[model samples]
Target chain A: MLDTIRRLVDEQGRLAVAAEAIGDNADLYATGLTSFAAVQLMLALEETFDVEFPDRMLNRRSFSSIASIAGCLHELKEAA
Target chain B: MCQACDSFLDRLFAKGVLHETGVDGLYGRGQAFEAVIEGMDRLITRLAEGDHAEVIRFPPGMNRALFEKSGYMKNFPQLAGTVHSFAGSEKDHLALLDNIHNGGDWTGGQGATDIVLTPAACYPLYPIVARRGQLAPEGGLFDIQSYCFRHEPSKDPARMQMFRMREFVRIGLPEQAASFRESWLERARGFAETLELPHHIDVANDPFFGRAGRMMASSQREQALKFELLVPIESTENPTACQSFNYHQDHFGELWGIKTASGETAHTACVGFGMERLALALFKHHGIDTNGWPTSVRAALSL
Candidate 1:
């Protein structure tokens, strides 16, 4: 999971650095994760896990970070 | 099908309504309006549950500075609606009142700020995500429904000054972005088909930049990168776009400083459903008679 995030950060450049500075609890929306980017991340997660993300999980909290995403994924996996 | 839509449309044409403004432009009233609202409510509720799409509501307008920084002004100056500020002295204010009383153009004297109404629902989401820490070696998703505004005025029911957009956004790696878009293309098409709407998946080209926008419209027919789910709502000859599948290719992630868990530029994609347009399409296809519709369709729409 960390590897995936690391890769995302590296590719994302300064945003990755900003995210690190903000720490996990900081609001991603406030930091800079525009709505468009959130959608992009959602697509990536869906592909990575080979699972379809339920629509209900599409919210600010769900996309908060790797931890929140992983939690959502775990829930999805368990449901499956 | 909402009976209100039928009556509204019928009355609109019967009266030969040429052009109207505001929400009234679309004639949202009577039986047609009620049917449309009810139908949309039911459809959205079902989709929210079935797709697990979380819903977020944004203010009608967005921050002006953010919009300018996002390159919206450069991309769509014509479609842009700017907010204004008032910085006038008492004399200026009194003069403005006098001008209004005299039927003079008072709008010019307000000294407004250039804030814009949000053209798309997802524009605000990126800055929000950027505030959060980097993705934890994984990406994220968001489902947002927003009241979007665009200044382009069209008489067609498919186009409106204000509209509802349901968007599913994915932010992550390039491969992930491609895959997600691919999957959604299929899913969106399926959704439309379920409603008995005939749709074809085709590539979409960005609306041409600058003077080229006009040429792009013509060229789009040949180089179909922009994919749209077309259904007949206002006109049978020209199908209206009910849904669109877009692969933005990290344009936003780069702009907003969003990164994937791997610390790389994230690719982005979205599936947008124009909820009001869909409701309109459904009404056109199924007619406004709730009683005459099929049981299964009625059950699905909860009419």
Candidate 2:
């Protein structure tokens, strides 16, 4: 799941650095993932993972890093 | 707000500083109120003279096509107010009048016009500058003032449906835009001191509309894209946002094809002064009568 998340970040996240350059817990925003790009990343994650992020998970923290996004996806899968 | 703060609106109306227009957030300003607003506008103009900014004044409405391209409805559909007109024939007009006379929905016949109310003072400037092609080496600086509209209506006099905004817009590189907004943060504090208005600056976000908007607004705050200079007018705890400095990173430029001298997408920034709110703040903090305002404040405004 972490690898897949990293792949998605590399594909969708418009970060200044490659997803492989940072750890799973690295701050995506601090690495220049813009707000608009985050929206694109969220949409891409939903499509790729077949899970919809609820309003409760729609926040900066939810997309702060690959690890956080994986954690949010795990929670969503559990709820499903 | 508290009960005491509610009385401030009543006192303004009673003192004839603002005339109630049978609407919650709409009011007519009396002569003294207009004078104060004019004085504040003059002070803003005087402070911005050093920048040699190009002054552009726009009407209350803007081209609907440009507005749609700006993507305002995507984020703030709730606050948009578009103009609609009765574009039907004479027979349709008669039917509309009959419906109105019979207490029916006459507005169903009204179609959307090509114009929408200007949401902010600088919304109209970008396309005009974009049409002019590339900016000068130093980039574009504009002084704009306009009557802007929002749909929110309330008893809080500071939150008006229609109000005037005086803004200085900067279009250039990211650093240039950031520095322009940064300078205003300092200049605004100085203006507040000269006017004797107690104020504070804080990271702020627009009231973005929905669930998706919540994330956008959070990201905006996290990135420090917007800031507000707040003053206590209706509520001490909440305080009114009398001025805002926003750094819109390439948003307007990308939408309008605005380009810097080096050909990169231009970043934009603006510092907007809520003209009516500032006047109300002065009235609330000082007194309703401008004649009785503090000596230093009066001198600063030349009132």
- DockQ of all candidates, in order? 0.02, 0.60
Show how many residue pairs clash in every candidate, following the order shown. 90, 0
- For model 1 the local lDDT of residue B17 reads 29
Q: After superposition, how far is residue B266 of candidate 1 from its true place, in Å?
A: 0.8
Clashes of 1: 90
lDDT of 2 by residue, B116-227 (tens): 9999999989989999999888999999999999999998999999999999999999999999999999999999988899999999999988766888998788779899
Which ten contiguous residues of candidate 2 chain B have the minimum total lDDT? B1-10
Considering only chain B, report the TM-score of each candidate against the true chain B.
0.82, 0.97
> Candidate 1 lDDT (Cα, whole model)?
0.66
- Strongest candidate by lDDT: 2
TM-score for all predictions? Answer: 0.68, 0.91
Winning candidate number (TM-score): 2
Scoring the B chain of model 2 against the true B chain gives a TM-score of 0.97
